[model samples]
Target: MSSDLFDRIAAIGVIPVIAIENAAQAVSLADALLEGGLPLAEITFRTTAAAEVMATLRDKRPELLVGAGTILDSASLDAAKASGALFGLAPGYDAEIVAEAGRIGLPFAPGIMTPSELGAALKQGARLCKFFPAGTAGGPAALAGISTPFAHLGCRFIPTGGVTEANLPDWLAVKDVLAVGGTWIATTSDIANGRWAEIAAKTRAAVARVREARGG
Candidate 1:
């Protein structure tokens, strides 16, 4: 994995995990994020428009660090790669998927909830991970607890699911967290209405929160 990939993601502070219902909205939504000072987005493959959106965003806004999320199998991985995703994210760690990602030279952030899962991800050469359902997984406290013993393992995490502006501070304050993921900034209505200005405002608020939490 290239160290620059992690550095790019970390620089953004927050990675918006977006699920686009309409492929047409992808480019505009990405532009809004960038306009608001964010330069990264993780477009999840949960919708039929995922691949199309990835392609559109890559061509229209190549500067954004685009990642494919909800990638569970090799086929999905291949499709995401073909669509120009710079990285891949899985809801849970699968050895096969992780191996395939590495083979294809794509940086991956697999999900893990327990120490055992984290160990498995590490064995697969994954130093960065996603703590899914982060709030239910005990949120920041859970990450802090795991870091106490496994911080020496050189593992870092991006807390995704359930992350909101309210708890982003607590999550980012944790030493083990590299970044956070959420869709609150790019709501469906904002995209539908072409509310780029509104989206940018929300994004600015989120970024400000991240900076405040980091004491910057």
Candidate 2:
């Protein structure tokens, strides 16, 4: 089931990292993403409305591939699963949390910044991971560099943090990158001001970049 979700994400080649301040925007946000040719969203646990937004989307826009982000512990993990998030992610790796995810069967991708962190995650059999704060961490060049040692390990990544459309292709160009976490697709201000069209436009532009990078 996790492999299917990951395959869908790779086919789209982008995951809109959304932080919703209000749950009421879920339907409109889903519509905007769909309008722009995107069907994936990572509802981050950065605000109080995260769970509600996920639940609303789960009930209203069932077609969208919704996942949970910033999942720091077992409690948040349980809440995310209950809210119908098909997958989960975090800013960093935690062994206990990863174990808990496996125990519950939630498709999870823990974050890894350093080789050691990546090693730790790989040690526990996690290949799909997040290269957090990608911009500060050297973007594609750095990811490509760190991933060299683990090339034979079947490591894949979802490069998040500071991932703008400008660098979206660069991130996608790396072989290890499955898809990018695009926070710019629909930012807080965009949703807050109900700029659905702008959100759709950004989503479309991101989709275009992914297609262009993949030579589609």
Candidate 3:
């Protein structure tokens, strides 16, 4: 992982997890997020339009930091890199996938909910990982406990599942957390209905939450 890119992510504090079905909305979505004062997007690879959407953003909205998500294998990781994604993430830890990411030079954050998974990530030299199903996995409390043993080893996290504007503070309060991924920021309906303004509003609120959480 590039230190500069990681720093940029840490600065943003809130990353929008985007999955747009229509490629036509790509640039407009970028515009909305930028308008909201947030310049980051994690385009999930689950949708067929993921790569195209990312490429469109890269060419048309170069200011937005685009990343790939839901990457389950090396093939998707390669596609994400080819699409010009700055980073990539998955919902679960896979040794092969982690190794492939290191080999391909794309900064990847594998998901973990237990110390065993965290150990796996560290063994592969990954300091930053994702805390998935966060709400059901005990949210901030779970992360705080699971990350304690590895905090001194330079471990960091980005808690995603169930993270939202409501509890943004609680999540960011953890010493090991670097950011929170807001799946609620840009939902499928929001994107499909072309609700750019609503998405932007939600994004702006999230940005505000991050600022408030950090006492900025």
Candidate 4:
């Protein structure tokens, strides 16, 4: 994969981590996000409908930058790849999954909670890591602290979990955070209520917040 892909992901600021209960809602959710000017979506493997949703989005809206999230094993990784995900993300690092992603030429961001895990990830050749359970893992402050030590290693982070609109600016302000991830903007309840417009509005608001934080 081109390094530019990482730049593209970072430019979006916040990646909408989505879990689809109904396969039919995939395209609509993707459309709402794209319309709001954010092109990236991390369709998580939290539900069985994830693969179907990935296939549907790939077939219907190929322009959206879609990836699989919450992948735990190689089987889930392969299923994501087969469904057309361009990348894969896990809540925690797994050597087998990371190796498979590399073999398939798919960019993967494995999770790291501590400096030790981060060090091990770098040893394994991962420059980009996910700070999962961001709130429980110390949020942006913890990330800020870790960044100082790991800065020389050229490590970057994508903060996920417990990320909210109110706290997004704090997370984005941290220089090491390349992007943030959250599911609040595209929850199943929003889709169930057919609130696409509302979701779009939330997406736009979130993007604006990121831009403001980035001084864009």
Candidate 3 Cα misplacement greater than 4 A, ranges: none
**CA lDDT of every candidate:** 0.88, 0.92, 0.92, 0.88
Model 1 segments more than 4 A misplaced? none
List the lowest-lDDT window of 10 residues for candidate 3: 176-185
The CA-based lDDT of model 2 is what? 0.92
Regions of candidate 4 where Cα sits further than 4 Å from its true position:
none
Poorest lDDT segment (10 consecutive residues) of candidate 1: 1-10
lDDT at 88, model 1: 88
> What is the TM-score of each predicted model, taking all chains together?
0.96, 0.98, 0.98, 0.96
What digit string (tens of lDDT, one per residue) describes model 3 on residues 1-216? 689999999999999998899989999999999999999999998799999999999999989999999999877999999999999999999999999999989999999999999999999999889899889899899899999988889988999989979999999999978889988989989999999999999989999989989998
Candidate 4 per-residue lDDT, tens place, 1-216, comes to 358988898888899998878898888898999888888899999999999999998999999989999999888898999999988889998888778888988788899898888888888888888899899998888988876887988888889999998899999899878889988889878987779999999999999999888887
For candidate 4, the clash count comes to 0
Clashing pairs in 4: none
lDDT of 2 by residue, 51-144 (tens): 9999999999999999999999888899899999999999899999888998988988999999999999999878789999889899899999
lDDT of 4 at 152: 88
Q: Which residue ranges in model 2 land beyond 4 Å of their true spot?
A: none
Q: Output the lDDT of residue 101, model 1.
A: 95
Model 4 C-alpha RMSD vs. true structure (Å) is 1.2
Q: Write model 1 residue lDDT over 1-216, tens digit each, in one string.
A: 468988778766798888888998888898899889998989898888999999998899999889999999998899899999998898898999999999998889899989888989998899889898788899899888876778888888999889999889988889968899998988777787899999999999999988898888
- 3 against 4, candidate with superior lDDT: 3
